[model samples]
Structure formats: structure tokens, C-alpha cells
Target: MLLPIIKCGYELCKSENSENLIARAYPQLGKIFQRFAILQFFNDYGEFVLHDVDPNLLTFFRSCLSR
Candidate 1:
């Protein structure tokens, strides 16, 4: 899966809704995350002010991560 640059954040990744990518693409990884009781899969906010990316990308990533 192609991902956005470090400046853009995970929000811009191809699989932002990672609800089933591993299941469809890599079943082993999906099983690992599902079996782990404390596993947490989430997007992340990248360097906003310093990197060349969307202005709202950081905030959007943060909001999604917080959930």
C-alpha cells in the first residue's frame, strides 16, 4: 500500500480506513492484531508546521488518532 509522505500524515494514505486491509492483503498480520488484547491500530499526525503538506492534515490525523 502506497502511503503519503511523512509530511502529509496517515490520513492521506491509500488505506485510511484500515478496517480490512491486512485481512484482505495479509491475513497473518490481521490475526496478530486481532489476537493481541491491547492492540491499537490508528493513523498519526506528522510534522505540520515544518513539512510541506495539507494545513489540516495534521489536525485531521490527530482527531482520527484520538478516536
Candidate 2:
């Protein structure tokens, strides 16, 4: 699921001259995953739990959201 989204984002970003890939893809990515219950899954499991599972993923999300 995420792999495909990441690939799509990469392709889209590569097609453009955008400096911030995350910012460009954030809104569309959020909409796609949010409907699939990904957002709910993250919400149900706290950030601490997510960090424990995958610190990099947590960090990535934090960085994207902060932008």
C-alpha cells in the first residue's frame, strides 16, 4: 500500500521541479490513506507506539506534518 504510494509520489515529484516532495504530495497522500483507515490506525496507536515500531516512519511523518 505504502510502497505504491511512495512510488507514485516519487514519480510525480520527479515529473515536476518541486523542491519539497513531501509538501507537494502531502494533501493527496493524506486523502488516499485516510480513507483506507491508515490515519485511524495511527491515531489509535499513539506516537510512542509507532516510534517503537518504526522510528523512521514516525520521524518522516513528523517532518512532513511540520512542513
> 1-67 in candidate 2: lDDT tens per residue?
5778679778888898687865867786775566445445656776656345355456557654555
Which residue pairs show collisions in model 2? Answer: none
CA shift of 3, model 2, Å? 3.7
Q: What is the TM-score of each candidate against the true structure?
A: 0.19, 0.35
Candidate 2 backbone clash number: 0
lDDT of each: 0.39, 0.64
Candidate maximizing lDDT? 2
Model 2 CA lDDT for position 39:
49
Q: How does model 2 score by TM-score? A: 0.35
Clashing pairs in 1: none
Predictions: Cα RMSD each:
15.1, 9.4
